[model samples]
Target: MSDWRASREAVELARLGVSELLANVAKHTASRRCGLRLVRVGADVVVQVFDESKQLPVVRTPDWCSEDGRGLWLLREMADGFGYMPIPLVTDTSYRLGKVVWFSCWGALPEAGAA
Candidate 1:
């Protein structure tokens, strides 16, 4: 993870984004389980959450006092990239189908001679 140039602040933001994604799965999806993956592509760290839900998440303009529907928005603001992909199930399973929602955080480069 450190090889990706992930700063302290970036790692924290990534954690928050993943937490929101999992919360959404627990609250919205019918599946009882989910998967999370963190990977580095170049200078960016990608956080992915997988769940058995064909319904894609939508970005909404919630009321100022509303407590819900802000997770994706927060992720969009914090992460450099955010998106989802539907996975087709080839075998019979309880989930049947699923989706993978992902967000990427661009890591900050270290200053020369700082370390």
Candidate 2:
């Protein structure tokens, strides 16, 4: 992720976004096993976090007086777009912890550059 800052040009913003994402996963889901997925798709850098939780994320006002909850909000503002993808909703009665908190940022590539 060295180029994270270089690529985003808004290094601090990108760093804050990534840091908050990790922290949220630890605090909200509290899952033991988790991982990050970074993908370079066209002109966007897609950041994905996978965890073992059934809770779906929503955009809500995190108490400003508190020390947290501004992560997703900030990320949303900084990113081109972001959202969660639930595991394949199958007909079976089996439930699974296969959801991801994902976001995309305009990379340093020309395609994403200001027109």
Candidate 3:
């Protein structure tokens, strides 16, 4: 993030979002293993978590009193954009259905004109 000149606030938000998304996978999915990817596209940074489960994440009304079920809601509220999509998990032996949940922090890179 520092290499890309992301603001402190953006870095913090990205960290929090990753934690929340991974936590959700551990709590809800049958498989504990997942894949994580981070990419920089122009001035934006996108983070994605790939899980074997085909189920898409749902953003529900967060229960302030509860410890669970608030991650996705908070992520959606904080990130510049967030989404999930069904993807093909192609392995050497088989093809499986999976999903990737992603969130983007816009302007994570400094503008070309900025010093």
Candidate 4:
């Protein structure tokens, strides 16, 4: 994980972003199951969450006293880039519409021979 970036803070922030994405899925989606994928794309570590819902997540400003609706906002601030893409559904009856929410953190690649 540290290979993607020398800063431990960046890795931690990416983890938090993924957690928030999953939490949003559990709180808002009709489907209880979700998928998570992490990979190094170019100079960024991309965290993606796949959920069986076509609805795109909205980033909204919450009141200072509010207890909810700040997850995406925090993700946007922490990640270098964040967005969602709709997955095309198959014609098969077993398939359902879904989307993938992703966040990427940019940084230098891990040093050679480092784990």
Maximum-lDDT candidate: 3
Candidate with the greatest TM-score versus the true structure:
3
In terms of lDDT, the poorest run of 10 residues in model 3 is: 106-115
Q: What is the lDDT, from 0 to 100, of the residue 44 in candidate 4?
A: 59
Report the error of model 4 at residue 73, Å.
0.7
Worst 10 residues of 4 by lDDT: 106-115
Candidate 1 segments whose C-alpha is farther than 4 A from its true place: 2-5, 90-95, 108-115
Model 4 Cα lDDT, one tens digit per residue, 17-105: 87799889989998878888987756557788988899999887767698888889888877888999899656556776799999887
User: All models: lDDT?
Assistant: 0.78, 0.68, 0.90, 0.80
Candidate 3: where are CA atoms >4 Å away? Answer: 112-114
TM value for model 3: 0.92
Question: Number of clashing residue pairs in every model?
Answer: 0, 0, 0, 0
Model 4 whole-model lDDT (C-alpha atoms):
0.80
TM-score of 2: 0.72
**Which residue pairs does candidate 3 place in steric collision?**
none
Q: What residue runs in model 2 are displaced by over 4 Å at the alpha carbon? A: 1-11, 88-95, 110-115
Query: Of the pair 1 and 4, which is ahead by TM-score?
Result: 4
Ordering by TM-score: 3, 4, 1, 2
Q: After superposition, how far is residue 70 of candidate 4 from its true place, in Å?
A: 0.7
For all predicted structures, in order, the TM-scores are 0.81, 0.72, 0.92, 0.83
